[model samples]
Target: MNPIRRRPHIDYELDAGGRRSLWQTLPTLTPGLGVLRHYERRWLRLDGFAGIAVVAYMVPQVMAYTAIVNVPPVVGLWTALAACVVYAIIGGSRVLSVGPESTVALMAGAAIAPLAGGDPERAIVLSSALCLVVAGWCLLARLFRLGIIADLLSQPLLVGYLAGGAVLMVVGQLGRVTGTDVEGETIVAQLRSFFSVVGDTHLPTLAVAAGTLTLLLAIVILRPRWPGPLIAVAAATIAAVVLDLPAYGVAETGPVPVGLPLPHLPIISWADLQTLLLAGLGVAVVAYSDNTLIGRAFKPKTEPGEKSVPDVDPQQELVAMSGVHVAAGLFGGFPMSSSGSRTALAIASGARTQVYSLVAAVCIIAVLFFAGPLLEPLPSAALGAVVIYAASKLVSIPDIKRLARFRTSELVLAIVACLGTVLIGILAGVGIAIALSILEMVQRLARPHEGVLGRVEGIAGMHDVDDYDQATTLPGLVVYRYDAPLFFINVGDLRRRALLAVEKENEGDPDHPVRWFILNAEANVEIDISATDGLKALHDDLSERGIRFGLARVKQDLRTPLERAGLVELIGEDMMFPTLPVMEKAYLTWAAEQAVREQTALEHQAVPGADEPAGTPPARPVDTNESDR
Candidate 1:
């Protein structure tokens, strides 16, 4: 005999001084530092230009979103500055621009307006408190590695939610543009209030609104890549100052607080804290959902064998956003999420890393300190026009039409969500959308797909019998497959469907009774306690009908539950096979042996009871074990 050759081991070691310490490795945890470690000089100019573009785009757009949050326009600047700076350091994505977004702003307003009771000061405090609570929820999610919850809200729900929010936004700005006191909680009531005061509209404000809208539409249609909102706002501000439109009863921003915001925790009552906590959870879900969606949409693509960029970790994203909202709360801003439009703008302008976000932050700081007075004369109508434009982008006619063509039910759900938001409120509409998403998921789980397995002439493995016209099944055998986890929700249904499959097969060819039933258990990776009981009942039913129950392709994890439930003993350990082919081969061998025995018994009976008295009845053939046949 030849001796076996063993591979030699080599020791791996390094001196303590040569080894890297934890502190040195800690910096890599922040994606920003990792990108900086490989920074190129050529990217500097590109990122700088991208950052400038982001500033011009965000300044007017973010200020307009503040109208949704019902906060001072300066507070929006605070949100942009703090969120962008913090996200640049801790965020997972290189190009994602985190800041005030219209949907989240609208949701924040919905939660705060009711509690503040028309006090703007109280509303600001509530907004800041809500930011802190949202930060807490994000941090909690990161700690628990619950990033998968981002998919809890379905796409159909989001479509409807955004559509609903757009209508609410346009309605909210009607009063500003018309210079009337439009006050109502619902769209119907708001329109009624607006019409009641339509006769008393301020003509100068209406004129400013018309000019601003026309300029915005023209720029958007002709020069889409241009800073349309900024241009529109600047022109209106210049006109307001030159024409003295305020004297004609046109409302202006008046005075914005100059300089940077001081970092301080917002104070609130314990009751308010409890109220804000719930609102915070909703806001966090929406923010994270949008952030993840945009982050994935613009993720840089690479070809095979190419060195790719570091992928964004979902859990790390939660941590980064937690820091972003914490910064916002400290700076007296509101809850914020990633703006898809701003992110697209940054990417389009050649942003290569988070450094662009830092540049944008610096520019916003400059605006907050040096340009606040310049914007004081900006007309409310122009801001309203900017907001209405932003809102219009939220509704996608193509998406709605696609849903209608592919899934009419989902289209209806989306419309319901929109109507719910307009008729009810932003927060409640979101609640309804989330509920609908959950219900849709439950409906799918409660009635999963199942199929009967058979063989086709050219097919290599088992396939659904219903799918193939020429598929054939083995005599006296039934192979079945259930394409979902065996849970309490649908285990009873599984039992009924499986039994019906066997009965249908037997009835199709009564001469070949189904003596063996085998389940393809590859998809049943999980089986809960109730499902185990249900499985046992199924086995008992098969046994009563003289059919032997067996399992094929059982997962390792499923063994312990089956063993604990005593199902393994009840079904017989020998009947469980590792693969379908092996099981089928063994069944064929047994069937051959049974056929031989039956033929022998028939021969003896024809020979006038070879083993019994001549006058006695011929011995009847009996099955030693039905499973063997």
Candidate 2:
């Protein structure tokens, strides 16, 4: 395997020998060295343009998401500042923008809300615990190399989930955009206070925010590379300052440290860990989904002529992503994830390597030290617009249309999620969508397609007797094929299916009822007690009726479970076969023996010279209910 670089920045001081100690080097490498590297590069012009643009848009975007978390606006700036430095050394993607995000912050707040007794200390500790869990979980996933879990969310579900979240995000920010802290868990509460508070709206703040949102949207539509958020904030900050907007109750992002951060662990407890477990999982799921998506988009360039990029190693991406957030939590930074919008922006602006992230980091340091003061009067509305617009991208009308084309179940779930977000919270909306997804999956599994196998005239292989139009059943052999695992969820259904197969066999010809039932156990991988008992009951009933039973193609692991339960012993060693061919051969031999027995009975009756009439067949009692049958 080719070794992926741990850091994005190119090494100047380290020789090949020093660089060989790859994992040991840290981003805490030296600030002076970073500045020197930034200025000494031949690619300075290209990087400078990209870096400045990222930093520009990042300012207001940072404040917007920070407010969504209901945290101090400075936390967002601090997060952007710290993450750019940390990921500069360890990040993998060229276009990845690591910073505060609406999803992560909103999730963090939800996880820590229970622990907050109006105490910032408690919130901080709980939040850190949550990040720790994410980091540890991600690293563990990497160790196991479990990337498939990310795709488990699926395209349809993701579209639905994001669409719901985006709508909720826009609605949630309405209060802030209108200059009120009227927070609610739902849409109605947000719109509830507007009647009384419209008169209280801060005109200057609204004006700046509205202008900023409009500008950001326009940039996204027209020249997405211009770093519109950064420009808007700068322009708005100047306007606010000149017009004395703060005097009209307009908020501002005050001073932020422009230098370095000293990392420290977050204070936490076992209780906090328990409380935040669900929220942490939400972060894990969303972060990996976003990371894997972006990593695949990069088309990992190596050979010039390769048409496809190598598949993303999702487990590793999770570990890297979780590590960044953990570091952020440990330091004075809030949580973050791969910024999908920003990553798209960077890629669209012609970023070629992960070096873009490194350059972006250097640019952020410059902002902290030199341009921190310029952010002072950035109005809340502009930040709100930044968030609203960022989130708006997540809602897709085309995707919803596609979902409707494919399946109604998916469309309904997506709609439910979208509506849920506005009615509930972002995290809650995600939870609802997941629950719906899982429910749909379980319904399919629980009602697995089982059928009676019958040979067909045109089809080469045996097909379902009831499902196909031109299938013919064997004379007296009943074949039941189960297509899902046997579990407690469908044990009752299993019993009913087994009994129905027998009833169907007798209904066709009671005199020549199926003498044997062959269970096609190809899909029966595992079995639980309830299903085993259901099978056992059917086995005893069939045996009493003189109907023999046999199993074909039971998986290897299922043998022990059958043996341990004495099911195999009761069914007889000769009855269970490894493959369908073996079972078919055994059935032929059994059919011959049954024919001989019938012939012998007829001969005995004829020889008896009137002991009994050969034309008369043994009678089966007529009964409709269990009491009579």
Scored by lDDT, the top model is 1
Q: Please, what are the lDDT tens digits per residue for candidate 2 over residues 1-629?
A: 99986878766774323233534543322322333454435445655566666666676677777666665565666677667766655555545677777666666665565566536545655655676777776777765766665765656777777776676677667767777666444557656756557787766667777888787677767976677777766777777789887787877666544555566777666776676666777777777767777667763233377344345445546656766777777765666776776776765655544566667777766766786667666676777877877787777889889889999987877777667755666667667766777777778778889998877787776778777887877677888888888888876787688778898789988887777788888888999878788788878778777677778888778878988888898787888888766777777776776677667666765565345567665433322113111
- TM-scores of all predicted structures: 0.93, 0.78
In angstroms, the error of model 1 at 433 is 2.1
lDDT of every model, 2 decimals: 0.87, 0.69
The Cα RMSD in angstroms, rounded to one decimal, for candidate 2 relative to the true structure is 9.2
As for model 1, its CA RMSD to the true structure in angstroms is 4.5
lDDT of 1 by residue, 398-517 (tens): 999989999899898898888888888888887888888988887787788889898999889999998999999899999999988889989999999989988998899999888889
Clash numbers, per candidate: 0, 7
